[model samples]
Target: MPLPRPLAPTGRVAVVAPASAPLDPADAHAGLSVLRERGLRVETADPAGGPAAYLAGTDDARVAALNAALARDDLDALVCVRGGYGVLRILDRVDYAAARAHPKLVVGYSDVTALHLALWKEAGLPGVSGPMVASDWGVGLDAETEADFWRVVGGDAGYDVRGPGGEALTPLAPGEAEGVLLGGNLALVTALLGTPFLPDLTGAILFVEDVGEAPYRIDGMLARLRLAGVLGRLGGLVFGMFTGADVAPGRPTFSVDEVLAHYAPSVGGPVASGLVYGHVPRKSTLPVGVRARLTCGAEARLHVLDPVAA
Candidate 1:
């Protein structure tokens, strides 16, 4: 897939909620302010008003909002307001044709992973697996996170993704591999399995992360990936922050690290952990479907080999 046009300094960005509504309206407003401060023209969709339980709105409303943004040639990018749930429910109804035609940057993570994977597979469109309005910008980004986000989106030259203090990721298995960067929230990626939306990850540098899932659950998901031959087809594998993976008191279970260790040997190439991308405040904004290289050893590094944006 070709890279989408980079966000111009004065680019027009449309903010829409395609998943769950914001937990706090104030946070959403604050996030929008951050975008304005960057000198970008920010447009927002009306709240898809409806009592649809956990969803931002009814399936039809969310789909309409997302599709409208995808079809707008005036927009340089579509920024998701937040990601909780609902994307999976409407993946089939998405406007893939408009996405292929417009090919604007679609930015968000978590539940937004479903949209990213679907857009990539169905329309050959690349996207930023980065922060969302209510999720990151609303609370304020750490210096590293803010810098990395703009650097990738602004069409800056290729660079290495490092920890907050320039530390290397922990090496799991020793080796080197290069492939397009793909994968996101573990649960979302796993859910897309057996679906047409899951991209062909053969030789792709797959990275995954999750929050609030137990070690056993993580083990099950990784097992499924291995059983489905997903792990064996990867050029490399990266484990990001698996936050909130602690087991309950008195529960007998393996540690998250142990679970990962059990599956590392099944990967086709190098493996690494501690990638600073996940549900945390500080993260490296990664571009999905972009070529990248990963080296797993004492001097481990993940390098973006292709420009994320044109």
Candidate 2:
């Protein structure tokens, strides 16, 4: 993974609704307040308004806001306020040249995965795809997740990521591997198939997480990756929190672990289980474009090899 440029205090950070719409005022207020309290300047393209069905506004409006922020001299970074849906609508609409020219941190996850891959593959900029302003920043973050966020953003070196000390942290393939970290929401990743946006995962550490999807859907998406020759190319794999996949009523099916074994034959890389990310209550912020080492031993640790830019 390439190192992210260091984020200094007083540096300006712009908030835009890249995926969903503008955030609810309450969520916005809390997130903005947190950013301000952390000693950074905060600006939003949405102001304090909500649009129809509430997406920062329209595709054009959201794109305009993001582009405007990119061009701004005061802003040092761009953070997505929330991620519900809508990024694909404006994928072609974004100005990659303008965004690359400015070169600032673009952060968010879920639907925002589309933007993360675009900014990296299209603009060649590294971005965080772990937490959203409305989700992680404003809300109270768990100690483990919070610590990991600052460690990465601050460019801390050689750290270990342990699972929530429980039986939940079981190995799938069991081994160690090093490669650039790449991946995000499972749905968004599969959706990018056959598009210019789907990144080349060759020799990359593919990390993925999702929320509220059935085990079969997760299996199907992984199957798609295998068919597309993605899984075969990865150097390593990490599975973040696969939340809300409880068995459906009257549906006797395989567990997430069972699904993992089903694809184990096709995956060539050393795979780890239970990463502390995804749509869970608290999660670490991850830079998708940075290279890192993933060790799956008694514990799972992702040691970032890229320096946080000085």
The candidate that wins on TM-score is 1
- For all candidates in order, the CA lDDT equals 0.89, 0.75
Clashes of 1: 0
Specify the highest-lDDT model's number. 1
Q: Which residue pairs in model 1 clash with each other? A: none
Model 2 Cα lDDT, one tens digit per residue, 1-310: 3333566656778788876653556776787888888788887777234564746677667778777876765666777888888888888878887767767777788989888887778877777765567876777566666666655666555555554342233457666778778888888888998989877888888888888988998999999999999888888888887889998689888888788778865767678767777888666667778778876667656677775343
Worst 10 residues of 1 by lDDT: 45-54
Tens digits of per-residue lDDT for model 1 on 1-310? 5567898758999998888988888999999999899888999974467537888889888898889889988988999999999899999999999999888999999999999999989998988989899888999988888888888887765678886657578888888999989989999999999999999999999999999999999999999999999999989999999999887799999999999988998996899998988999888888888899999877678999887679
What TM-score number comes out for model 2? Answer: 0.90
Any idea what lDDT model 2 has?
0.75
